[model samples]
Target: MAAAHRARHWSFGGVVLVVTAALVAAVLISFSGSVAPRADAAVAAQTWSDEFDGVAGHAPDGAKWTLETGGSGFGNHELQYYTNSTSNAALDGQGHLVITARKNTDAGLGCWYGQCQYTSARLNTARTFTQAYGRFEARIKIPRGQGIWPAFWMLGNDLGTVGWPNSGEIDIMENIGREPNTVHGTVHGPGYSGAGGLGAAYSLPGGRAFADDFHVFAIDWSPNSIVWSVDGTTYKTLTPADTGGKKWVFDHPFFIILNLAVGGDWPGSPDGSTAFPQTMTVDYVRASSSGSAPVARPIRGIGGMCVDVAGASSADRTPIQLHNCTGNAAQQWTVGNDGTVRAFGKCLDVAGGSTADGAIVQLYTCNGTNAQKWTYTAAHDFTNVGANKCLDAKGNSSADGTRLQTWRCTGAAGQKWTLG
Candidate 1:
């Protein structure tokens, strides 16, 4: 999605405004022995919105959006000249906004590749609105033709200073005419951007083209997580652990953007048979807010050590150990609604799906299997669903790198956890 990667990553964090060098180094060790819970709240309330109510031929709400006019390619090597004109974008008088891309040979606009061959519109809410974690979504019927591209995305508010990639970006939906039945959701950040962005694609069944109908595209974003869906089908989820060794840059506010480009590096150029007046119709767009920001505090246990991922590696099979509280992303765990305990984009899995007395716990890809599912009892026991065993500091020891394992439900100090 780097082709559309507006710029994006994450941790067990909530709306972080800044990241200094010290903070980066402290990722592994949480000082003060604070025991904090993994996460809280999902889509809470409607914080900001625009329903496109207006007369026909009117432009987008100027109070909420700023139309960006440029032909410098916007770093995408696109062909269209973005203009602030009603000719390119306007309300349809029926609760919908239509963004039309017209082939204009004589637009009389200065562009990176000489005279512009097309005209379209790009609108953003940089100055008027920004949100950190929430449900961001839109419903639209896309225009289809060779080289026609349309996107509903977001970029970090610190764009002017931090710049692309580092500023973060979340592409809720992007479609290229070449893939008539498909759309993609992506996150781009420092180590992962442009062509290397981490994301997934969704395609309509029955060989149906997205241009033939309006589809609901969205992302449910929270601390340390971003889930993407198309018409209610969840396709992908991203987290800080997915960025390799790079920083998770999605802890701040990001503004929304909607645009339709005629041609670009991703969709190529319009062909002779391509339609001239291609239109992208948007029915609505909305963002919901998160109630309480989730804190990825350390989970302290026996001897005052925290539950940790050995070596801070996100690779599958990484051991879950007992280490002196380090506030690093590797030690941060978020409790998923599905009863799965997660850290570094993976789940706390029973090794080999073992149901024995001494099976060690490890971080592995989250599958819906019972081995990866568990319930934290009121008494502080992390009991595995399938094995009916409780988490234990191996051999009741509290030493560093003491691997944790599952045992018969025990109320001993080794099995008790102090969570945030």
Candidate 2:
């Protein structure tokens, strides 16, 4: 799973409904002080009841996170020397995790290649707090000036077994000082990996940068989908179909990591206009499960385009065609807890599994296969279980003449299908 293989299949629909805006605004307002939720009048809630409780305002107390140090360069032309000791990384008492990069006069004892001048910390939950599906968020205020790139992200816990993009990378929040107001959320995996990986940038309203205040950046991950949100409002989604015909790398467990880099190819270096030793103040970090519940029902296709099965055919490559209606395994679908939808034991797959329109739909083995993963968008559209291709008719043909196929989504109602 190379990072470039995670490129998203782009599509634009009507403006997202503003329904979640009010709720997000309220959460931001309530986040001013400690993020404690009100208790019932009869019973007092615990102090850490909020999502980020316990993990904020200091170096994580529990053994859930490990701080990585040492002068090992992380491939980036960074100025700071990474140290494993807590001396350089600690709670500033003002409620900020300070990871300072200072120019040193003598780089003798702490030197890596030779005279190393700076030292900072990289924290990770690689040994603790690995989770599958849930909502993850962090509220942080960043330091200003150039050459600063801060990130809050997750890596598949199976990194040792799978490696790199194959293990998957979920970047929940990433920002460079130059692009202050614009934050990125990305997913990197094999096939769609690299600079154009599956990702999107969310800009603050009125061109506001996130450095001045604490903002909530989050991601809602389910078996079949990954939704990126800012302040709790979903702005982007990535599905299996978006990555061609690969496996859905998100079903397994992943651990979190947070770091502030001095310079990188993406963020570049600080010029004369840049400032140094910038800090990213994290108010808190939190993770939660989707809660114990039964899997949701699969959406059924309607509008008289149901496939009609005449009789039992050979299991190998048996093709079923769309007709009036016929309740059969070839037509009926069963969505599994792992976010895969199967019919006749074959996974539902997009034609050529391509993001382009008119791609036919087919069935294949599940196998944690990415093409079998589908995402239901708020617009009631079914995107490729791997990529973002929409389940569409060959054209906008409502008549029987239109062939059922997958196409690059235009976000039309005809392309919308209900997952019953």
* Model 2 agreement with the true structure over 1-420: per-residue lDDT tens digits: 122222221101100111111111101100121111112111211111112333333554545456665554464445556565555556766545665554445446453346665556667765545666666777878655576777888777666555666778898887777777788888878765566578788889998878888888887665556767888555666666566677669877777777776655566666777655566767777775532211223334446465322243313234434554444434454443345454533456664456655666665433455666765556656667566677775555555434456667787756766543
In TM-score terms, candidate 1 sits at 0.70
Can you write out model 1's per-residue Cα lDDT over 1-420, one digit (the tens) per residue? Answer: 434443222211211222211121101112223322323323245667888999999999988777877687776678888788999999999999999998776647878899888899888777677777767889999989889889999887776567677889898998888888999888888888877888888889999999999999998676677878888666677877777779989888887889998776777788986988999999998876532233455678999999999998867899999998868877787654466677755679999889999898998876668899887766777889889998899889999989999999868889998776
Prediction-by-prediction clash tally: 14, 45
After the best TM-score superposition of candidate 1, give how far the Cα of residue 51 lies from its true spot, in angstroms: 3.3
What is the overall TM-score of model 2 with all chains considered together?
A: 0.59
For model 1, what is the error of residue 287's alpha carbon versus the real structure, in angstroms, after optimal superposition?
2.7
